[model samples]
Each structure stands twice: as C-alpha cells, then as structure tokens.
Target chain A: MPDARSTPVTAAILVIGDEILSGRTKDKNIGYIAEYLTSSGIDLREVRVVPDVAEEIVAAVNALRARYTYLFTTGGIGPTHDDITADCVAQALGVGIDVDPRARAMLLERIKEADLNEARLRMARIPFGAELIENAVSKAPGFMIENVIVMAGVPAIMQSMLDAVAPRLRTGARVTAETIEAGNLPEGGYASDLALVAKAHPGVSIGSYPSMTPAGFRNQIVVRGRDGEAVAAARAAVEALVARLHAARG
Target chain B: MPDARSTPVTAAILVIGDEILSGRTKDKNIGYIAEYLTSSGIDLREVRVVPDVAEEIVAAVNALRARYTYLFTTGGIGPTHDDITADCVAQALGVGIDVDPRARAMLLERIKEADLNEARLRMARIPFGAELIENAVSKAPGFMIENVIVMAGVPAIMQSMLDAVAPRLRTGARVTAETIEAGNLPEGGYASDLALVAKAHPGVSIGSYPSMTPAGFRNQIVVRGRDGEAVAAARAAVEALVARLHAARG
Candidate 1:
C-alpha cells in the first residue's frame, strides 16, 4: 500500500513491572525484542518502562498504540495480584475481557481440569476479539489486541510469544548499515567532517560510538539507511575523512 | 519545606542512544540507575530510551524534567560525533553551552595541554550554570542542569557519577520493604487473598514476582512503603495467608 518513498514501519516497546522500577529485576525483554524487530525489518523507535499500575499502563498503551504501527508490552500478565496488565489493556482498548476459549484450551493441554484453580485460570483471560499468542515455555499463552502485542516478562517465554506473532506483522525494507573502524582516532578530530558527510547523505544516519579499548578510546562510525547506495557512500566518506585525519597526525 | 508529612520525591531516567535502538547494545544504565535512585529514596517511576537525535533528547528532557523531581539521562556524553547530549541539554534548559573551566581542569588532571585535542576537549563542554558530577572512574565529568542530571552510559563511570550527585539531591523518606518467600506455592492459588491483603494495607505496595527457579515457578511477595510499620503489617498478613494455604495443602 506504500509508495516508493515509503517510511519504515515503526514500533514501540512498553515494559510494565514494579520489580523493574524497584531495581529488583533487570529487564531482558526490551533488548531482545528490539533486536528481533530490527532483524525483521521493523524500526523500534521508542521504549518505556513503567510500574505495575492500571492507570499508568492504560495511558501508555493508548499513547504508544496511537503513535506507532505496533506496541509491544512485557510483564504483569501473571496470575498474581500485581499482574494487572491484562485488565489495564482491556480498559485502554475499551474492550470487555473474559476467559477466551482458545486460551483456556491452551491451558487445559498442560494443566488438568482438577488443577485449574482460579489462579491458573487467571492466565486464560483475554481481551475482546483478540488472537492468542502461543507460549511454548509454559502453556499459558499471550494475546494480541489490535496493534498491540502483549507478552511475558520472562525472557524465554517472551521469545516464544514473539515467534508466534512475527508472521502476522507487516514488515518493511531492512535497513542496511556499514561500520568503519576509526582505529584510535578521536571522534572530535572528524566530528565536523562527519556532520558534513551526514548532511550530504541525508538518507543515511551516521553515528559515532566511542569505546575505551586496549589501544585507547577508539571511535566506531556507523552509517545506516534503507538505501544501500546512500549507506555505502556515507561509509566511504567517513573512512576517507578518518584516513586524512590520521595522516595529518603523522 | 514541609511541616509534618512530605510527598515522596519521584524521578525518571532517559536513556539516549542509537546503538540501543538498533539492538547492537543491551542497556545496562537504566537498571543500575533505577536501583541507585531507589536506595537514595527517590522513586524511579518512568524510564524512556530514545535515539541520538537532538529533538528527541530535548523533548524527553523537557517532559521528564517538568514531571519529576529529578530526571537522570545516560549516554551521548562521550567525545564522539553522536555525543550531542551536552548541546541538547543546553537547548532544553534554554542556556548557552561552552567548555566549562572546572571540567577542563578535571581533564587536565589526566591529559596534558598539547595532547588535549578538540575530541578530548569535547568532554569538557557543559551547559551554562550547571554543577559537575565527578566521574572518579575516568577523568571526564558529567553535569546537572536544573533537576535533570546527565551521566555516562558505561556502568562504572555512571556509578561514580551517581555517587557524586547522590548527596546533593533533595531526597524524601526512604521506602522500606519486607519480602516473604511463598515457598513452592503458585501465585494463582493466593491471588485473591493477596488482593485482600493489599486492600487492607493501602499504604503499602504489595507486589508478586514469579520466577522459574530450581524449585519451579515460585512467587516472591514484596511489601514496600514509606512507613516501616505498615510494610511490616502487610508482610505479616501475606505470611499468615501462605502458612494457612500450606497447612491446607498438607
């Protein structure tokens, strides 16, 4: 449906948990999801982490869903008192929630009927007209409502849920990137020139990351764009500039 | 400034980088900063990750600074082309940015005058009328403008910077927490009773975290509040509920 000069498909990740805000749990889901979406040709533009509060979740969900093509939320869907993500999501979408037959079927495959206490049944709750995202780690499945994909907070389970929903997403052109090692050259030596190159190749996003390596603080300049020619041209310009600066030092 | 009871001081962290958005670097600063601020009695309620764009940085700085008592930003402070956090911060605060004499003095503690090239000198730039947050790990310093504190992305350097600013912050009453181990009980088994416990102790924030340990999916309930007595009371109720459930199972 997009024209030749189509913009990239964008997504935002919302991480919901009190444990994370409290610094009790280090989140592993955001990075994993960012990498996965990037490889799948989706641009992850923004990420937010909020505590397990109903109003907070609803506000964030509404804001991000309206802004991006998709919004992925992790955590707070478990069978506990603090796991209010589902109810909050339902309220955000203005949809009534009940135990979905598909989700209950998935749970019944792993949990016996006699063992299906109210606690385990809590995982089976689904928003109106949502599709179930299968969880291979545990039988408790995640669900997708409209443009938002809700998944588990645990790394292993979220990965499985992501795999289940990947096929349904509308992908875009994969971004092409080229990295030029600036050796030991300080970024300040070529910052102005790099800016000129970036201006010249407006399509390519040129970035410089400095690391304190054994050789010293080495700068790595990266140029990324959907157009291969633009990315490659920017990379060549950066390399040429760096070579000039290094020679000037000699 | 307060007569008797004071409102809790809240904070937010803004993580800026293209590497994080592109999925090349997994973020380590948010968790470290979140935990550090929590122990200091500042509630880290929101966290956002945005790319190294000046507009994005300025927008986040403005939003977070206006909303929270303190806003901490990590990344984009290095001496590289993408390290525009200084300029962006100045713009956000509506101030001029130039090389700070104090920061230059700190850099001179390590590097000689002749060796201090423009790239290395980039680290000395600070917003107008801002306080420097010392980085003992490295010679480069971070800075604070108004309520927003800017620090490094590297864990060691950020930790040292946090220590420098920790003493200067207007911290509120420290949150006290009590944790009760739920043994091998599933959270679903006690979700309802836990909700009741939470309702009765409205002052305390009770949270349930489920993790797959060697024993299995064990629930760890944490009760947190500014009032130690309230936290302790809620924790006792959770413990009693777990003990009763265990006895019934036996």
Candidate 2:
C-alpha cells in the first residue's frame, strides 16, 4: 500500500445551472472534468449540481469549498440574468465583487468597448483577491478565489479553463488501474470469489460492472490503487481467479 | 404567478458509482430522470454524485432524503460485490436488508432456479418494508424506502424503474416554459435590457446561454415558470427585446 502521502489532494465539483437540473441540457462537463482530475492525481470525491438559485449556489459553494482541497464550479457564469454564479461565490466567501480590470481586459479582446454592454460585462465581474483562470477558447476568464475555481458550463470552454488551471493545482499521487474482462460469467458465479480477492488485496479498490445490451450481459472488473505494485498484484490475482473459473466451466 | 400548489413537490438525485466518478462512464441517467421528473411535476432541486463508498452513499441519502420530497438513486444495485447501494440505503434508513421473496419471484420469472447463484440472488435484496419498483427492461427489481427510490444505472432500466415509481410519488404543479433564440445578438449588447425584463417578470426565471461554435456565437434565452400567464408574459417581453435589437442593427 502506497501511503506515501499523509494527506491526499481532493476536490468537489459544483455544477450550477437551471437548464441542467430542468433536463433541457445533458451535462458533458462533469465526466470530462472528473476524468481530467483523476488523471491529474486530484481525487474528485463529490459532485453537486444545483440550479441557478443564488441561495442554493452559495450554500453548496460554502459547504464544498470548506470540505475539499479545491472546489471547481461549472455553469451559471454566462452573460445572462440567471448567470449569478460569480455573485453567489462572492457571498460564499464573504467577499465583494466588481468588474476586475484583468478580466475586463480579457473580455475586451473579444468585444470592443463600445459593444461591451452590461450583459457582456457581467462575465468580467471577479471576486475580490482572486486569480484569473484564462479561458483560451474565449476571452471571458474564469477566476479562482481561495480554494474555489469557477469555470464555464459549456463543455469546450470548461475543458480549456481546466487545462489553464490544472498547472497551478496541488496534485497528489495518481491512481493506477487494471481491468480484467469476465466475459459471459455471471457476477453471481464469481461474486464470492471476487469478494475473497478484494479481501486479499486490501490496498486496491475493486469494482465489478455489468451491462446488458443487445449482446447480453457484459461484465468487467477493475482494480485501482496509487501503488503500482499493489495494483499489479491485484490484477494478477483477479486474472488467476477468472482463469480458474473458465477452467471449471470447461 | 400561478400559486396553484401551496407547496411544490421537489426531488434530489443521488448517483452512486465508481465508473462514473472515474470518468469511465458518462452518466445518462441524471438527465433522463431530470426531464422525466420535470414533466411529472416533480421539481428536481439538486443532484449529487458519489463514489461506491458505503459511508458516502449513506451520508448523501440522509442529507438529500431529508431535504427533498423524493430522493432517487441510480446505480450500485447490480449483482456484484461493488453493488452495495441496497445495503448502504438500509444503513441510512436504519433498517435491515434481505432477499425479498417478492423480488426473488420477479427474478425467477427470468432466471432459472439452478442458475440463481449467490451473485444473482444479491439483486433480490431489498430494504425492509420498502415497495418494489418494477424494471420492465429486466427482471431485477428496484425498491423504494420512505422517500428514496433506488434504480438501475443503465439508461433503459432506470427509465423503466422511474416510470414504475412516478405514479406513486406526490407530485406538484408542473412548470411551463418558453424559449427565445437570439440568433446573432450579443448578450452584452442587450444585457441591461434583459435584466430589466427579468426584474419585470419576477415570477418567471429568465436565462441566456451563449455558445461559440464554428459558425460563431449563438445565444439562447429561456423563460420558465409554473404560471402559464407569467411565462407567456416573459416570453413576449424577451421576443420584443430581441426584435428591438434587430431593428437597431438594421
């Protein structure tokens, strides 16, 4: 077991959008960010999707930012009346918000000053004492206040914002995983054996997932851990168990 | 504003899975249920996704089930060792779980008795005193305890389970909405006007979303409310604003 790090870096994602909660939009950002954070060695422990309501957003932001090493929020940062994530984040941190010069400069790169109306300027309103997270796709930069990092809800922009912020994030040991396909074998046939394997490889996290499609039930087992040695050992054990099951059936 | 229902019925979704958190699977259930619940007059207030940890599932269940009128959970009910949603749910409700004869009978309709191994039998486990939600896609049944409805993570199965449980839920007045597309008008160009419209339509929720595609930026404005009159009124105002912007450009 690799317990090298005394405290592992962790994060929680807060997806703020009424459209998402109302089911008008299928969220693509959560999976993208989750995979990115996992690969970057930041444990994405929790994700909460709240509507555009200010109170709900504030409460979630406060709770999540306090618990996780970092809090990443997507959505509600647009130039619309319902876009209140910036203000809600300010409320959560008890900081005043205004149109920051840095963010305004970035916005100007896309829109001329004459064309920058109130709605467009809303995107530039940054919380006090926050660092800008450059939006490479567009000019409206996301900002990081304390431990909370806010980004666009749109998949493409959110991906760019994540890439910009990832370099500065405090990361821990990345988890490594191995998968073993348990073709046609019912989980019931190998459930007990899998549990025993899990018990033996206490350091690795083992999971079995079954999907029933036109082809029928397809089962896959995965083992994950930070320690490469532990993951390899668990993979070997799982492979042996599956091989034994195959032999018994034959 | 339509205040037809004295208190609106609300719901929260608890998505439990390791594959989803690992980013290996893009969640399709949340959006499906969100749309389903919205049309059924159940306001989906919040959504939380957690890993396959027992304690995390228990905590999320306790928090969400306490706050919302209904708490729907998806995933972790399969016939695998990692499928602990049933047990964790029981722990959250302070109840015991066992293989229910009703669920087993349902399972037997599909699987032969000889093939019903321990793993397959695991799927029949339900929390004590809970009502079973039928899975039309498969024989495995989901159960509802108190306000919590547990279902399969697979999109097809989850939809069937939700359909089975929706009729029994205490739903409130359904929300109606209208959409206004601002094809080329920049949100910044009319942001102040949009805010004024939002203030006028306090009973309705107004939102603007801008997307930058290969063609260019496309903006969409949506107005939503439980009141037919209020929603219509907001829609008219948004249409007029977009029209005025068009005239100015001409």
Which of the numbered candidates is closest to the native, going by highest DockQ? Answer: 2
The residue pairs that clash in candidate 2, if any, are A120-B188, A188-B119
Q: Report the CA-based lDDT of candidate 2 relative to the real structure.
A: 0.91
Question: Docking quality tier of candidate 2?
Answer: medium
Candidate 1 TM-score to native: 0.93
Q: Per-residue CA lDDT of candidate 2, range A142-222, in tens?
A: 999999999998888899999999999888898897889998887778988899999999998999877776888878899
Candidate 2, A153: how far from true, in Å? 1.0
Q: Flag clash pairs in model 1.
A: A119-B188
Off by over 4 Å in 2: A1-4, B1-4
lDDT of 2 by residue, B70-92 (tens): 99999999887889999999999
- Write the residue-wise lDDT of candidate 1 on B1-250 in tens digits: 8621267899999999988989878898888887888788889999999999999899999989999999999998877667889999999999999999999999889778887777778899999999999989778999998998999987778889999999999888888878899878877778888989999999999988877876667778899998888988888899999999999899
Q: Candidate 1, which segments miss by more than 4 Å at Cα?
A: A1-5, A213-218, A241-250, B1-5, B115-119
What TM-score, over all chains together, does every model reach?
0.93, 0.97
TM-score of chain B of 1: 0.97
